[model samples]
Target: MNRSACLIFNPVAGQGDSEQDLAMIRAILEPEIDLDIQLTTEEISAEELAHEAVRRGVDTIIASGGDGTLSAVAAAVVSTDISLGIISRGTANAFATALGIPDTIDAACQVILQGVTRTVDAADCNGHRMVLLVGIGFEAEAVERADREAKNRFGVLAYILAGLQELRNLHSFDVEIETEDKIIKTSAVAVTVANAAPPSSVLAQGPGGIIVDDGLLDLTIVASLTRAGAIAAAFHLFQTASAGNGAERNDIGYLRAKQFKITTEPPQKIVVDGEILGTTPVEIRCIPAGLKIFVPSREEEEAVEKLEGLPNLTIEEKPSPENSPD
Candidate 1:
C-alpha cells in the first residue's frame, strides 16, 4: 500500500522559487508517497483544493505558502482525519514558526516524510476558520499597513514599520466581551484571541505561552493610552512571553476561555490568521483537538514532555476527530 498526499502550492506567497521548491519536495517524497500538486491561482483556492483533495482520500494535505495560505488549507482539513503539513513560504509564516516548522523546502518536506502527527486545537469565528490569533485595533492596523510591496522589500520589518505608524495614532474603543463565565466591558487599543502563536506575537503571549492543544483560547487586551505607555506595555508583554509567563501589567489583561463573543462600540476591522476579515462583533469558539498536523517528531515530543508539569495548561492528547464538539 502506498501513502497519498496533496501539496497545495501558493505561487506568490513569499520571496521564494516555488518551481524549484516543488521539485525538491517531489524528489524527496515521490518515491514513498503518491504526491499530487495543485497550484493556487487566487485567494481561497487552496482551501477549495484542499477540500477536493480530502474528498479524494488523500492521507495528508500539505500547504506550501505563507500563513494565509496555510490557514485556508488547515481550515479544510480540520475536524477530518487527514493530517495537515506545512512548507513555509510566507512573510511572517507565524503558524509555521509556532510549530517550529523549518522554512527551508527540503527541511519542510523531510518533516512530512518523517510521519509524525499532533492533534491540535483550532477555532471558528463567525463561520471563518482560525488556526492562529485574531487581532483587532492596533494589530489589524499594522497588518493593513504591511502591504505587499513592503513585504516584498522588507519582509517582517514591514510589519514593524506599520506598527510604529499605527502606534502614533492609537485610540481606544469600548468593547464588550462575553465568555461562558463572565461579561466584561472595557476600553481597549488591541485585543487578541489566540489559538496558537509564536513568541514574536507578543500580544498573544499569555502566562503559559500560547498552547496549541490547550482546548482554550488566550485573550490579551491592551488598554494603554499614550504611545510611550503602549510601547512599555508591549515590552512588558514580550518579556513575559519570553519567560513563558502570562502578561502581568495593569494595562495589559490576559485570560483563557473556551468561547468568546466580542462587540465593539464602533465596528473595527479584524485580522484572522493574517488576512483581514470584515468588522467586529464576531463569535469565536474553540474546537478542541480539531486539527491533526505533522510536526517535527523529536522536538514536539520533547516540548510536550516539558509542558506536562505546567499548571493550568493541559498536555497534548491524541483525541479522536469524531469527538470534536459541534
Candidate 2:
C-alpha cells in the first residue's frame, strides 16, 4: 500500500537554490509515495494549498519551506488524522531544529518515508493558529531589528547581532499577566510564551526545555535589568537553553499554564513564529495534541544520540550568575 501526499513547496523560502531543493525532494519522496507537487505562488498561500490538499483527501501533506510554511500547513490539518511532514528549508528552521527533524532535504524526506507519526501540542494566539512561541519586548524588538534584508545578508548571525544591539537599550516595563488560577503583576524586559522552541530560542526555554507534546505553554519573563545586567542575563539564558544551568537566577521568572493574557504598560511589540504582528495585550491558549507530524523512529533517534554523544544536562539550579559570565 502506498501513501498519497501533497507537497507544498515554497520556492523563495531560504537563500538557497529552490530548483535543486525541489529536485531532491521529488527524487527522494516520489519513489516511495504518490506525490502531488504544488508550487506556491505569491497569490495563493501555503495554508490555502494545504486546505486544497485536505479537500482532495490526501494521506499526507508535506511542506517544504520555513517555520511559517510548516505552521500554515499544520493549521489546515490540526486535529485531523492526516499526518503532516516537514522538509525544512528556511532561515533559522527553528521548528524543525526543536523537533529533532533533520534540515537536510534528503534526511527529511527519508523521515517521511519511514512513516512514523507523533502528536504534539499547538496554540491559538489572538485567533491566529500558533505552532511556535510568541515573544514580547526584548525578543520582539530583536526580531524586528533582524529585518528581511538583514537576515538575507547575514543568516542566523543577523539575529545574534540584533539581540546584542537590543541589549544596549534594554529597559523594564510593567506587565499584568492573567492566567486561569491567578493574576500577577511584574516588571520585566522580556516575556516569552512558547508552545514549541528550539534550544537556540533561549528566551522561550524557561522550564529548562519546552515540551511540545505536554499540553502546556512555558512562560518566561526577564526581570528588570540595566544595560550590563541585561547582558549577563542574556548570557545566563543562553546557558539555560544550552546546558540547563540558570536555575538559581531569581531575576528570571518561569511558570507553566494552559492559557495566558499578557498586557504591558507601554504596549510592547509581539512576534509570533518570526512575523511581527504588532503590539501586545495578547492572549494565548494551548490545544492539547492538536497536531500530528511525521518524525524519525525511536530507533533512529537513539542511533543519532549515540552518534552525537550529547551531554545530558538536567534542570538543577546553578550558582546565581549575576557575575558568573560576561
Candidate 3:
C-alpha cells in the first residue's frame, strides 16, 4: 500500500521455477500496489527489464531471481532513486537472505505488501557492483568452477563439490592490502571484501558472520595455510560463522572501512556477489545506506536488532591498495 511496483523475474532460476504461479503473484500484489510483472525471456534479461522499469519512474523494482539477478538489478539501480525489492527464486537467494527476506515466493509477496523500507550499503570494484560480497582467490575459483547443470540438479550441494575441487588446487596469492593507515602483507588463500553477508546459497562460508547495514566492509583474509592449516582455518571460519553476533579480533581478520584498495603480486579472479567480475587491484568504497529496499516490519526489526551491537570501525591504511593487477 505504498506505491506502484514492477517485478522482473527469471523463470529458469530454480528447479521447475515456472510462471504457473505468476497470476497468483499478480493477484497478491494488485491490492497493495499498481503491479506490472515482467517474465524474462532469453533475449531480455531481468537486469535489462529493471532498467526499463526505472525509465518508467516505477518507485520499486523487484528482482525475482538468484544472487546473480539481484546483483544485476542492484547495478542498474545504483545512484537512482528507484528502490529494489527481492523475490527469491534462485538456488541460493543470498542477497535476499542478507536482506532477511523470507525464501518462499508467497511469503516474500506478503512482506512486499507490508511495505517497510531499509537502507543498505553496497560496494564497487573496477566496474562491477554488488551488495553482498566481492572476493578473490579460492572463493572466486569455486564460483568459476560451480556447475550450472549440477546446481539445477543438486541445488546448494553443487557449490560444495566445486569448493572441494578448488580446495585441492588452491594456491596462495601474495597480497599487499593497504588502506589509509597501514599496509599489511600476507599470502592468502582467499580474501573477501564484503558489504552484506555472502550470497544466500553460500550459507556455510565465512561471510555468514557479516552484517550488511554497518557501513563497513568485512575484510576476511584467509591466510595461506598448508593442508592441515587450511582445514584448521576453514574450521575457524565455520565456527565463528556459526556462533554469530559479536566478533573476536583474531578469530577473524575483521576490518571496517569506508574505502579500501587491494593489490596482488599477481592477478587473481574476482567474484562479486555470485558473478565473476574481472581481477584485482580493485578499489572498493562503501556507499552507506545506498539502497532503499522493501521488507516486512518483522524483517526490518530483525535487521535493526542484528546490527546494533557492531562497533563503527573504519580503516584508511597507508599505501592504498588501488590499481589494476600487475
Whole-model Cα lDDT of every candidate shown, in order: 0.88, 0.87, 0.75
- Pairs that collide in candidate 1 are 206-246, 207-245, 207-246
Which has the higher TM-score value, candidate number 1 or candidate number 3?
A: 1
Kindly list the per-residue Cα lDDT of model 2 for residues 79-117, writing each as its tens digit. Answer: 678899999998899978888889989999999999999
For candidate 1, write residues 1-326 as lDDT tens digits: 77888889998889877788778888988898887889999555888999899899888888998888899999998899998989898898898888778778888888898998889999999898899989988899889989999999999899889999998889999999999999999999999999998878877775548788989999999999999999998899888888777777888898899999999988898999998999899899999999999888886446644555667986578779999887
Better of 1 and 3 by lDDT: 1
lDDT of 3: 0.75
TM-score result, candidate 1? 0.90
Choose 2 or 3, whichever is better by lDDT: 2
Please state every model's RMSD to the true fold in angstroms: 8.7, 10.6, 12.9
Q: How close is candidate 2 to the true structure, as a TM-score?
A: 0.90
Residue 210 error for model 1, in Å?
1.3
Task: Kindly report which residue stretches of model 3 are placed more than 4 angstroms away from their true locations once superposed.
Answer: 198-208, 245-252, 299-326
Error of 2 at 220 (Å): 0.4
TM-score of each: 0.90, 0.90, 0.85
